[model samples]
Target: MPLLHIENLTHSFGATRALVGIDLKVERGEIVALMGANGAGKSTLVKILSGVLTADGGTIALKERPFAPKTPHEAAGAGIATVHQSTDIVGVPGLTVADALLLHRIAEHRTSLFVSRSGLRREAKALIDAAGFSLPLDRDFGELAAAERQLVAIARALADKADLLILDEPTASLSSEESQRLFDILRRLRAQGIAVLYISHRTADLQAIADRALVMRGGRIVASFSRPIDFSSAIQSMIGRRLDAVRPDARPVGNPVLEIRNGQLAATSVPFDLTVKQGEVVAITGPIGAGKSRLLSAIFGVGRFACGEMFLDGRPYRPRSPAEAIAAGVSMAAEDRHRSSLMPAGWPGHSLAATISLPHLTKWYRKGFLFGNRERREANRAISRFGIKASDPLASVWSLSGGNQQKAVIARWEAEPSRLLLLDEPFQGVDVGARREIVEAIRVRTDRATLIATSDPEEAYEVADRILTIDRHALLPTAADPTTNLAITGT
Candidate 1:
């Protein structure tokens, strides 16, 4: 019998129907993967199952018993827990490892307020050890790395005694090694008879851990398959068509467009040399803290190069700051769109307009206050061009879905023409339609020279004309050459 079951689930936001008549089931100890393009209702279903949002209509059952959790706390109480892709840990600086663990125990009411510190510490230690984490018991959780933060989230879910674990894009930012460690932990959890609902865009991770796969499109589950499924067929189902042909702009390589000669960032210990050409996409792949980010930052002028030189379009260009980089015909779409790219508090129209008319805005802001009417007009133009889903231009960015939020970020860069574009994880949480749109946009930008960095090998192979792997702070050419076989590897 299935451990959890859903039937005829439907949901919407205002007039927008986000999900329609969806059904799914997870058997005991099974790892089920939910695959779809961004905005395909995968997140909506997750929200319903995790009790973060109520469904408009549906029936849910667990162990053949009616199941309706009213709150996230209730969902945990009923043995379902979800770990979101974006880490949401707060107040960590004030809380010790033991305190964080005990807080979970307190949330579940497993112990009284007067619980002994020694007992809490002992239990916390056991959980940490069991999860293969080696943090000091008294250390603050805020000091831990990104992977450690994820492990802590998993530990908290385990503490709830959850029977089903829903992980959303858990490996998006992880390095190859950190990702392998996470897979190890998932295997351990599976061995303990825990069912997993895995959500991710990377086909490699899905193939590694999932027992069953469900492809969602247009707010519906359109296809389902058991294990040993073909990767190409699965992707085709998710995208609703074959994506075998290389993008038309992905032309044969030519002369270098941008060159980095013995570049070094003293603050980050990144020393590398590389080049990107017109009509070619080059990817930089490495593990977390491998200085891949720092390398991009240095190249894009977010950080200064302490030594070496950079040439853009055959002209010496060492930008002192991001503004200088933009002035030199370079733009970067950051990895953390919410914090780094989007203006969270600004009105959607204002943000879109600012990005679309950045070159003019930069000049206008220097002279005087921006004309509100003109700004809105430009912003509206960008919104329509990018097909951004929002009711009003004045809507706050926080009101949009994750995929739409990402699209807004892409629109910012796409509005202005540049000599070289640098994108970091451009499709992180984007849906299928949005992913296709973004990829097509990149393909179009190939005539303008583009470089993208991603952790997913399949994504790299899909979008890049050449794959460059970062190993020991050096860039090495991969087998993604036009004439060579595409052989992926970790260094």
Candidate 2:
């Protein structure tokens, strides 16, 4: 019998039908890849399976027995574990990895007997080893890098005695190396007869470890494939259209729009010089923690450089904060939508209109005041242009799926004009189609100098006029021959 089985799953949010008649199965020792476009009901199905939400009409079975959990803890106790895109699963900010790894045990022991710290550390170390992770047990869980924190969450799940594991976009924030390590761990789990449900937008990941693939469209399972999958066919099934190459529209480059000279990202790091011309798109690529973000932060006024000079259109520009950056015709779409970008409690329109800091959007007598109709009009226009899937403009930003949420964040930045645009990992959780649309929109506009910071070289190749690498906290050209770094054919 399969480890997990679902039949006729249907769910809705008010008038919006999120999922409709979904059926799926995952057998032990099998790894299944779930592919879908934004708002295709993938997140809704996952939530239903993990007990975060209940299905309107459906039946679920584990080991051929009826199963319906009322809460996440109930689901975990029943041997189902889900790792969501957001790291909020490991909720305690100050908890150590050792403690997090043994959280289940600690929670189970409702006795006065205290557990030994050394003994717990040894146990946690054993669990980490078993999961093929090298995370430091002594480090605070929240303080670790996003990838490390994700690994810690997975380790904790494994330690809790999981039989069916669900991972949602696990590599969205991880570096390539970290993702590979995670793949290795998943393979080990599969060998041990653990059922795995891997969800991702990355075709490369599906190619690497999926034993089978299932494509979801409009909240229904539209296609499935066995091993040796044809990824192009799978992607086509998910989006209901032919996949196209994501190349930015070619445009002319003009005079320099921004320049940085002797900018020190870190106190002890060497200074770097860079220039971006109008109508040019420059991509900076590097591994995580390699200063890609530092460069972007410095430019956007989120972080200060130790010593340097920045000029915007031949004028001295040093922004002390993000507001100042915006005031000076600089727009930045920050990474980590959940933390820095999305307005969790605000409506979608509110989130989209937040980026335009113009007095017209805020002043009472102006046309774009929040209480007036301008913000709503802009939000509607952005939703149509960016392909955001919110049914109502007043719907909370937190209600959208992760990929759709990412689109909303990027749309906010692109809605208004700016001299320079900074996008950091804008494609983190975005689907290929939406990513292509966003890149095309930004590149085709050719109204500003856009700087994109990403860890994926393929993204750089697709959208950038110039590609630079961050090494030892400094930026340098990837190759002397600029043509060699140009977009690939078909792009």
Candidate 3:
């Protein structure tokens, strides 16, 4: 019998139906993959399963027993734990690894009284060591690197002793080595008879870890395959069709649009030199802690280089801040869009329009208010151009689906006539349809220079004109063919 089952799962946001008549089942000790293009209701289904969102019509059964969890807390009590794609830990900047894990346990227990901190710490230490990690228990989480942060999140979930664990794109930002470590943990969990529901866009990972695969589209299970399926066929099912093999375009290379010589990331010893020509799309891929983000941030001025000689369009240029990067005709769409890109409480229309034509709106800031009509006009134009799904220009950005939110951010940057575009994981949680739309928009900017960083090899092969790999804090070129999985190495 299946460990968990969903029947006739349907969900709608207002009049828009996000999911319709979806059915799925997971058995004990099974590693099942839920695959889909963005907007196919993959995230919605996961949300429903995790009790973060309620389904309008559906029945869920745990071990043939009717289960209707109203909140994440209720779901946890029922032995279901979810590690969401979006970071949701509170006071993450201050919490330590042990503290974070204990906090999650306390939350699951829902206790209002004092707990034994010593006992919690002892248990946390055992769990961390068992997971093959040696992180300093007293170090603040805010100081931890991205890979370390992810490990802590996973450790928290495992500490709950959950019978069913849901991992949503856990490897999206991780390097290959970090991902391998996670996969090892999953294997351990599987051996313990705990069921895992893994969601990811990286086909290579599915082949390595998943035993069964379920493809979701338009909020339904369109296809499923047992183990040993070909990777190409699995991708076809997830995308709902075959993708044309990407070939490098034969275009004349123009003068260098961006150049960095002996760039150092603050106090780090990792230094590299790189360049991008006009109209070229370069990709930087690497294992976790390989300094991919630092490189991009240094160039974009989020983290100023300690020492570097840089040139933009044949002129000396060194931006001290992100605003300076923008002023210099460079725009970057950061990986953490929820935290960095969107102004959650701000007006959506104004936010979308300001990304492209913002200097005009800045004049109104001094007047202490914005002209709604002007903001709406520009926002509406962007919404139509980018195909953002919302009822009105005034819709809250937080209310839009994840895919649409990503599009809104992309629309903001794409509207600008930028000289250099740095996009970090432009399609991280986006659905397939939106991915195509976003790619098309990027491709249309043939006159501008662009650099995209992604962990997914398929994304790099599909969108990049040239691929660069970061290995041991250095960048090296790789073949740009989509047919083969390129092995990134330090040269």
lDDT leader: 2
Question: Would you estimate the TM-scores of all the predictions?
Answer: 0.83, 0.91, 0.88
For model 1, how does the per-residue alpha-carbon lDDT over 1-491 read when each residue is reduced to its tens digit? 79999999999988878889998999888889999876778888988888889999989997788888889878877889898866544226667877876676686577777778788898888887776666567877766545456666766666566789999887776666766777888887788888999998777788888899999887899999897967677788887888664533436656677998877656355566777888777777766665566677877888767778889988998888888988888888877665467654555434555545544566546777767676567557656766777776655655566777777777766666688888888888775556766777677655667877776665676676667787555666555345434433221
- Candidate scoring better on lDDT of 2 and 3: 2
Which model scores highest in TM-score?
2
- Candidate 1's error at 320, in angstroms? 4.0
Error of 1 at 430 (Å): 3.3
Q: Which stretches of candidate 2 lie over 4 Å from their true place?
A: 96-113, 116-124, 136-142, 346-372, 480-491
Name the candidate, 1 or 2, with the larger lDDT value. Answer: 2
After the best TM-score superposition of candidate 2, give how far the Cα of residue 227 lies from its true spot, in angstroms. 1.6
- Ten residues in sequence with the least summed lDDT for candidate 2: 355-364
Please report how far candidate 3 places residue 110 from its true position, in Å. Answer: 7.6
Candidate 2 yields a Cα-based lDDT of 0.80
lDDT per residue for candidate 3 within 1-491, as digits (tens), equals: 89999899899988878889988899999999888876678788878878889989989998789888888888988989898876646327777667776775566565434756676667778878777665677788777765567777777777678889999888876767778888998999899999999988767788889999988877778888998856567667767678666544546668899988877665556677888889777878766666677778877888867777999998998888988888888888887776677764565433444433454445445676866776677678768877787777777776666777888787777654789999888887775556776777787677778888776667876777677887665676655444554333222
Candidate 3, poorest ten consecutive residues by summed lDDT: 482-491
Model 3 clashing residue pairs (backbone)? 37-431, 37-432, 38-431, 38-432, 175-288
Separately for all candidates shown, the number of backbone clashes (residues 3 or more apart, or on different chains) is: 5, 0, 5
